[model samples]
Target: MFCYQCEQTAGGHGCTKMGVCGKQPETSDLQDLLIYLSKAISMYAWRAAELGFRKEEIDRYVVEALFTTVTNVNFDSERIVNFIKKGYNILAEARALYEKAASDQGRQPHKIEVIDSWNPPQTYEEMLAESQGIGIAARLSQLGDDVTGLQELITYGLKGMAAYADHAAILGISDPEVYKFIHEALNFLTADEGRDADALTAMALKVGEVNLRVMEMLDEANTGTYGHPEPTVVRVTPKKGKAILVSGHDLKDLAILLEQTKDKGINIYTHGEMLPCLAYPELKKYPHLAGNYGGAWQDQKKEFDEFPGAILMTTNCIQKPAETYKARIFTTGLVAWPGVTHIADKDFTPVIEAALAEEGFTEDAPEKTITIGFGRNAVMSVAPTVIDAVKAGKIRHFFLVGGCDGAKSGRNYYTEFAQKVPDDCVILTLACGKYRFNKLEFGDIGGIPRLLDIGQCNDAYSAIKIAGALAEAFDCGVNDLPLSIILSWYEQKAVCILLTLLHLGIKNMKLGPTLPAFVSPAVLNVLVENFNIAPIKTADEDLAEILG
Candidate 1:
């Protein structure tokens, strides 16, 4: 198993024997095969699009298939094999679509040796063997490290884009532009041509450009389906009774579960990225919706085990379930584990039964609360006050300090950075990384809370909108504004978000708890020279550098 598409890749290099995320060699290799299948589908799908022929199901299948390979999303090899089998059927349909288009054009179809002319294997062992030819090391040998690294960067960015696009599709939102770019990008990776570093880098930024649109579509989906998030105080403590904890980034899954368990005496609590769901008017209307239960995904081992009710992981950020709570934890959507119960049909009756069986919180815990839901609408509503504060020099700077959190050692830098932020500045945070400092009091500038929680990672669109609005008000480009982006990335989603920022020509951002192992030194230099992007140093050192 050679994988290094995440920030926590082993020893700052590829993971060979097993993923640091606890993914086995077979599972990892099968995921590679699944990716190969998705790329094969895209090769035909891209041409079909060019020929003015497209199918929504084919587009959605490729998106979900790519999403399934994202870090920590799927660990069940059997489930992955099922996806691979399904992919072959879709690939045939894609091929036939291309043929129809080609026939219309009165020309023979174009072919690629490995992708278009290849036959998918029938069995699991054959699939594993198939992954070997297309694996990372094999590609690195075929193409040099720099080119392959850039290609992987684009691939990982596409995975992130697929995740957000899938989320938007669930909310009944779809865009052909997003689908077109995804297919084109994947096809570019599938073909042997255009593997030069400069070409690959340009494609990576284009992935960023499309990712921005996907994020915007997702923002619209969330705010339109559920009313725009309002500034509301959420309980961070547990309520006494039967409970079900919903972790991960899927708000739709949380809403469905809340409806199913509302009158059944199960109190639903959000964990990890789901913490922002409490602010949505449509979701927050549930009477039995309890409160947040835990921190980021990396701490789930201790937190999930201690929780006394059923736990449902709606999307990614799943860990190896501890034996103490293994039977009670369930996986749904694209998330899976080898032996964990999976809710494929969205009927969470099994989850409710398990919750009722367990002794949920013996009694009410001490009450604690935090304010969330400072999304674009919530923040822009008070734009006048924020603008006045900035003009009057009441707010010194704005710091965007959050991303996907992890179990890495240097992550405390975020907590310390937030703690050390000046009293006059505002911190706009999102995703699970907010757990590092959301619990602490950052006070407020006039009526504005100093720490603004801008929904989940996908809600990055909200943050971008907020910044653009602020920049417009100030009559300056975003880079000229007195704002600093301090981001921490753990997985592929973070990779795409960073790319989006760079695509916008946003500069001088600090990214850490470590750079991705997949980024070569030459590529790093290019980013640094062009965008002024740099890895984070100590909290104090970075603070001094930014403030001074």
Candidate 2:
């Protein structure tokens, strides 16, 4: 199917034959149909809301449906088909309400087409054509081409927003407004009229604004529930015996694993985005939570190859598993693979059993440590001191050098940028982008480490929080602060986060290593003129630009 919703879309255009992320043509077709059904459901929900329908009942379903379409999230065709059917069922219920209302008003009831009535593809070419057709049709017949592009942009932003919202929900936090915007925006995408480019542009900005709120809600949920992250040193060294490597960005899953494995003689190490989990007070309370195992998302195949214990992926960014580590790998939550054992909603018992079955390190591994726990709360507690240091020339500059990491060679710009920063400056990083140079010893400014590892990509929430607080302390706008955001993006999550930054009027940021393939030059011009966004240059050159 023709899908270009991600950075690795085939040939930087669209994945026509098959998804480079291991999604088959059939799976792509199903995902398209799922979106179609989700749009139909959104339409019904929107109408119901206008008629004073109970919207709360359908909130969670709206979040889940949007999240299911995110890049690299769900590849299971069977699971997607089930969701499509579920959406249809919900739409049917809403239709019944509409019919009753019309009959009571003495008017003829209108009929709605069943979601299942849409033609399913019989061949690969048909699937591809259908996929493109649906996207184009949504843009033309519903949202005109430009508005369609903007709506899709906002929809993708909402997908990221829903993922974060879901994470907060797991932590027992809920924001009705976040869900409200998501539902409204999804409905707008499906609307037959009032879908002009200007209107969609306004909605796109609104999505970004609401996303900021969602991120704040999640940040509060995480820090308030788990205690703010604190600076703690984690080791990069792996032990010789049985060790289990945990990856992805879910702190709750990591916390449970740490709790269950306490005093069980099994060593736990953080991997990927989980590398920053060591900063959270509630999670770090466990004594056996070992050091980090590997670098970023791109390095997993090689790193997982020699890992001696079972590896658990709690979320996305999982590449094709190597044969050697296939049996040792496990997936949870929305992440799934064909042969991998998926830990379901009820329990992670199977994953724990597998970890236990594989005997951990035979001997105590060498003690090595890497510093973590530099999220917003931890940083804000010391904001006044940071401001004083900046003024006194002890901390000359602040660099936000983070974003998604990928296989592209140009990503080395991040490593070099981190390396070239003045000794007096501090580097703040989050997401997989930090893997480029997290291992480098940037030394300390006073007691604070020069390089701070904020949480995951979503933890951009933390970075934003810290920036705003710092701006407040300095009695100036956030853009007036010493910090500069040098970001590398490879996915839609990054797109949403960047949009949030732009929506907040944050300017003069550097984005790289390559521009998004989906951004038409016209749209790019608007971003450049309005946001002052630029691609990353050589480290020395960028350093001069920022420091000068």
Candidate 3:
């Protein structure tokens, strides 16, 4: 079980025995095998699509299967095995489609012996053993680190893209071209193209290209469903009532749960990435959709234990459930933990029951508040003001200091960096990383709040759109703006976003808490040369350079 896909991998390298996120080696191996099968399925799926046959269910399953393997998403080996078993069934249908398509075209299908004639072991134990042959470590020796690293880079980016794609699909928005690229990408991994450094690098950027579209699809799905987010202050203090805390990135699930729990004496509080949901017009109308509960995913163990009501993890970034609150914490939509309640089909009856059975806050905590909802639309609405302020030298610079937050040590760099920003600059942030100094005051520059939370990692499209607008306003490229991007990444969604930035030729961004272990030194050199990407220095040191 060699997993180095996240920033928290052991000793800044691979996790061999257990995951820093508490994933067991068995689960890790199973996830590896599941990805292998997905690639096999895609081998046929991609060919079938080329031959004019497509299956939406097969395409969607591949996306969800990849998302399930993302860091901290699914830890249940049984759940992963179920996906593997299901993949076998999907593979059969995909191959059948390819055969039918080829027959109608008056040609025989090309035989890819690697995936076509393969059969995986059936039992869980055998499946785990089979994973031994399919894991990334097995390929590292054969292909060498540089090529293998680039392949893994593409896979990681696809995992992030798959996550965002699934979210958009849940809201009834999707693009066949996105699915096509996904299958084409997974299929790319099964062939010789993955070993070419130049070809793999290009494929990685294409992953970014399509991911940009996926994020746009998600942005549209979210805003089209719920009206654009408005600048609104949220109650950070716990109210004196039964409550259900919803975490993870799925706004649709939260909305359904909000509708289910309305007037049932349960206040729905958003946690972590879900915090931005409070600003959406459609969701904010539910009076009981209370304020945010916690800061980010890493603090969930303590936060979940202390919360007196039910907790729901709607998507990724799930940790190993603690015994104290495992019973009350539920997971849905590709997130799973062993022995924890699993909510399927958007049902919240069990969650509501758990929330009511526990005592909520006995008394209202002191009224504390933080303003959220500074999405692209909200920020751009004040474009004239912001533009005028920047032009007048009232707003000196722009800093995008945001990405996935984790429990690593160097993450404090983001906090110190944000805190050290001068009074004249505006800091744009998104994802849970904003938790570092979000609650702290940055005050305002010319009536524009110095700290702007752009929404979840899913709202990166909003950030990109915001930058494009600023560039257009300034009559220059985004790179020419007085903006510095400092990102802290922990997971695959961040990977895809970084790829998007690289794809757009955005340069000189700082990325940490550490560079990915999967990126070989050669690949890192390429990034350094091409994009000027740098591992972060000390907060004071980095701040001095950026401002200078």
Candidate 4:
């Protein structure tokens, strides 16, 4: 097994034996094989699209398949093997379209031997045997590290884009061109033909360009479906009732669960990235949608153990379930745990029943609160006030210290950084990283809270828009504004966002807990030269550099 698509790759290099995130070597190999076949599917679609044959559903499926392999997402080797089989089936259909398009165009299609003429074995064991021949080692050796790294870079960026796009599509929103580029990009990585490093690098940036669009689509889907987020103080304390804890980033699932569990004498509590749901008008309206329960995804084993009810993970960022509550752990929407019950078709009947059967908080927990819901609409509504404060020197700087949170020890840089921000500065945080300092009181700059919770990592579009607005108001470039972006990355979603920042030419931003192992030194040089991106240092040192 070889994987290096995440921040915590082993020893700043690829994971050769097992994932640092507890993914077994078998699961890692299966994920590698899944991507290999998914590439085949994309290759066919790319050729077919050139001849005017296209399938939006196929394009969407490619993204979903890749996203499932993201770190700490799917640990169940059986499910991954099943997903690979599904990929081969999809590739079969895609190849037929490619062949037909070629015939109609009076051209013989290029015969890609492995993908074009391959047949799946009869059993899972045979599938694994076949997968061994096409895994990352075979592919990476052919391209070499620099070229392979660039391809993986582009592929991983697309994976992140697909994850965001999938979320938007769930809300019945999508963009055709985004899907088109996803297929085109995935196809670019499949064959040795036209795989120039510079061209691949350019395509990686293009993935960033499309990712901006995907994030915009997700922002629209989220706010449109749930109503614009408004400032709300969520109780950290749990109320007495039968309880269900909902984690991950799927608001649609949360919405459905809320509706199904309403007045059924069950209380729904947001966990980790789901914490921002409390700000959405439509979701928080249900009286049973109780307060947030945990800090971040990493704490779930402990937190879920303590929580006296069923836990539902609606999207990514799920850890492997412990045996203590493994039976009560439920997954949906691309998340899978080996022994956990999965809620397919958005049905929460089992989850609701589990909550009813378990003991909830026997009485209300101690009273505590955290303010969230400072999304674009809410933050931008007070734009004039913010601008005025900036001008008057009351708000001296803005810090966007956000991204995916992880278990890495160096991740404490974000906590120290956020804690050390000046009183006159405003900290804008999103995703699970904010769990580090979100509950701490930063006080307020006039009527504005000094700390702004800008929804999920999905709400990055909102942060970008707000930054553009701030730059416009100040009559300066985004990089020239008194803003410092310190991003903490864990997975592919953060990769796409970093590329987006580089695409915008937003220079001198800091990224940590560590640079990705997949980014070869050559690629890192390009980023450093072009965008001046830097790995974060100690909080005091980095803070001094930024403030200076």
Candidate 5:
């Protein structure tokens, strides 16, 4: 398959035989074809936009198709093949719109190149044949790693923006600028005329800027739809009842599931990234909305096997299902597996029935609980006290240590780093990566919890807001504050968030367990020389260096 878009590429280079994420060769090839076609749609959409023709639907599809290709999102070959066919249809429509717009302006439409031209295949076999010539390996043959890496960096960042923008769009929040950038970035990647490293790198930074807008849109959509998050304790034990465990990042799916399952005698529990959903006032209002069931997506194979209930995945971050519990698992909204039932149109009837038929927890698992929901609103609400605490010497330093969680051995650094922080310092975290140390009791600094759980990875917006607030209060730049950022990234979403931090000119950030395989040495050097981005060292050594 030759995929290296994620952190855990095989042997730190590429996954050639099969995806480490359990994506089969056929599925991987189909995903590549889908991306290739989506770029064609983007090329047409960009030209159409110049002719005063624009379609938000096409713009959204561009983002979504790219997002579907992200790691651990979709694995069903049939589903991915269907997405490619659908991309062909979208591209055709976009091309017609572009041609019409050009005719209206009395100018001839630009000629379509072979790479950007596609026709729908009649069968999956034909689709696979078409994919061989359109994969990343072919693109790399024409461009070196440095140029290709920068292009992929921009493309992956756009994918992350699309994922966040899709979530916000569900809640009826969006920006035209974000959509315009999507079309522009896609066309840039699809162009046959090669771009130099400096130009590609410049476009990548622009992706970061647009990603900032995308994240802001999502922040507003989430807070507006579900109310600003507040600190609350969530039960870790599975309640005794027929239960439904919901995972992934789609709050809309969770809301609908809660509504459908309410008063039906089924208890709803959050799993993985869905754990933060419990803090939303709108979602938490359900009396039967029980508690969280798992730590992070990486641990789900074991966790899902152990949970005696139906599990629903509403977004990405799905693993290859285990045979024992595969039947009880359901997918929706771009997440797919071969054997699992999929809930489309927000209809979770299959999941509900599976939960009722299965044997749920006969007894509560334990009385353990964890605290979350220190979002921007919650933290800012206590801003005065925080400022006073910092001024009074009760809070000496701040560390934002969080990102995606993976199964790599070096991941223990995050847990160790969190554990080593002094009592006087506050460790703020968000995303699944926080699971590393979230269960460890860090106690509170006076009245403030030492380990502040911001929302999900998308809630990096909250961390940014909190850091900006702190900087404004202290009358210093964010880099000048007594705060350090320690991030561990797994996928493209983390790429966008890291880019957003860079867009804000935040420097000296530490990223680990390893740098992205797509980041060539030249690209890495650019990041280091400009932003001072550093790979992590041992936890003890990093702790000593940051404190020093």
Candidate 6:
């Protein structure tokens, strides 16, 4: 089982023995098989679309199927096997639809086929090739060295896109075109005939384009429902008493939990990507919504253990559970684990019970607050003043510094970069990367805080909206604005967001803690030459470069 779909793939290549993310070999193979089945469904769905099937039920399955394959989303082999069964069921339904269409048209309906064309190994040589990195690379090489590489990259990007799309759909926001693009892209990856370098490259860019749309739809869904984020200081200090630490990027889930536990004796502390929830008026209005409790996702094993209250993971970036805190943890939505109590659709009772059993802090702890909420709407509310400050030379630079946070030590660059940015420059950040410097007090440029914490990783949507608006206000292209995107990526969600930036022709962005191990040098060159993408240097160096 060879997999290289994430930033931390073993040795910057494929993970052959087991996943660095704690995925077993069997789990990895099932994920690959799951993706293979999803592609078959995609092909059927695409054909049905071509034949004028409008009310496509296959679209929902397509989204869920792709989402299920994302890193850290599903590590349970049992659940994955179940999803494979579900995918087969979906494929059967799609085949029936295709057949019915053909029958109505007096022609032979195209039969849905699952192609597991991988060569079966009989000899030691063949078995070795199938098991080693060289063999896996060869199969990927068949996708055409360049074409396969690009398709793999885009497939990872779509994984991220599907995650964001799934989140938006939960909020009753659905984009049919985004669904169409996903189906088309998934089919393209699996198609035997049209898989070529040029075609795959085009598909890759198109994934980025659709990801941009999904992010936009999510931005609209979030800000429209929760109100735009604004600058508000959120305390990092834990309050005295029992608390529930909510992690990951599900605002609706967080909102529901916040509502349920508001008057109870329990306190709600935001963790990891949930840090930005402090900006939402509805969420922040809850007096029991205490300050942030931990750092980024990668630090959870240590931080979660130290915390006294329960923890809820609404999404990904969860490492393997530590024994000390495993039972106190609860998972919701797409997140699942064998031992942890999972909060299902109708009931959060388990989470409440866990919180009650944990027995939070006995007395009131020290009170502290850290400001958050600077989403697009909140930022745009002061656009006129921001423009004035820029004109007045009070705000010298605008840094769109955000992305996923990871365990890599190089990530300290982000913390230092944000710290070293001129006090005159306002730093706009989203995702877990904001955890690095959100606590820093950079003061304000005019009325705007020097550091603005946007929403979750999906809230990159908010950053994009703010950038587009700033471009319009400044009467220039987004690239020509005073903004610089210094991003740090950990998982596939970052992949999709970066692709969206590329699709939009945003240039000179700095991507680091590390470049994705999946990106071949040739593909990296294509990005650098075309999009001016660069890796991050030291804070002093990058600061000079961006400000220069």
All candidates' lDDT scores? 0.92, 0.77, 0.92, 0.86, 0.88, 0.79
Task: Give the distance in Å from residue 438's predicted Cα in candidate 3 to where it truly belongs.
Answer: 0.1
TM-score, cand. 3: 0.99
Q: After superposition, how far is residue 89 of candidate 6 from its true place, in Å?
A: 0.7
lDDT at position 256, candidate 5:
93
Candidate 3's residue-wise lDDT over 328-360, tens digit each?
Answer: 999998999999989887888999999999998
Model 6, 1-548: lDDT tens digits are 88887777788777989988888877776666667667777776776666766345688877877787787777777776666666667776776776676677787866443433433333434333434433335567555456666877888888999998988898989977777778778877767534676676677788888898898888877877887776787788887878899988889999899877867789999888888788787778888887888888889999999888888999887778899999898888877776777777836777877888886877765776677787777888989999999999998889988988877568889989988888899888888888888777788866678888777788887788889999999999999998899998888888888888888999999999878776778888988999999998899998888877
Superposed model 2: Cα runs more than 4 Å off: 50-52, 55-57, 96-132, 136-148, 192-195
Judge candidate 3 at residue 130 and give its lDDT. 91
TM-score of each: 0.99, 0.91, 0.99, 0.96, 0.98, 0.93
Q: How do these models rank on lDDT, best leading?
A: 3, 1, 5, 4, 6, 2
lDDT for residue 227 in candidate 2, whole number 0-100: 88
lDDT, candidate 1, at 277: 91
> Which regions of candidate 6 deviate over 4 angstroms?
54-57, 105-107, 111-138, 192-194
Model 5 TM: 0.98
Pull out the clashing pairs in model 1: none
Query: Which run of 10 residues does model 6 get worst, by summed lDDT?
Result: 115-124
Error of 5 at 181 (Å): 0.8
RMSD, each candidate, Å? 1.0, 3.2, 0.9, 1.6, 1.4, 3.5
Question: Judged by lDDT against the true structure, how good is candidate 3?
Answer: 0.92
The global Cα lDDT (0 to 1) of model 6 is 0.79
Tens-digit per-residue lDDT, 148-208, candidate 2: 5566677778778888888888888887667656767877876644366667667778888
Poorest 10 consecutive residues of model 5 by lDDT?
Answer: 113-122
Residue 227 error for model 2, in Å? 1.1
Clash numbers, per candidate: 0, 10, 0, 0, 0, 16
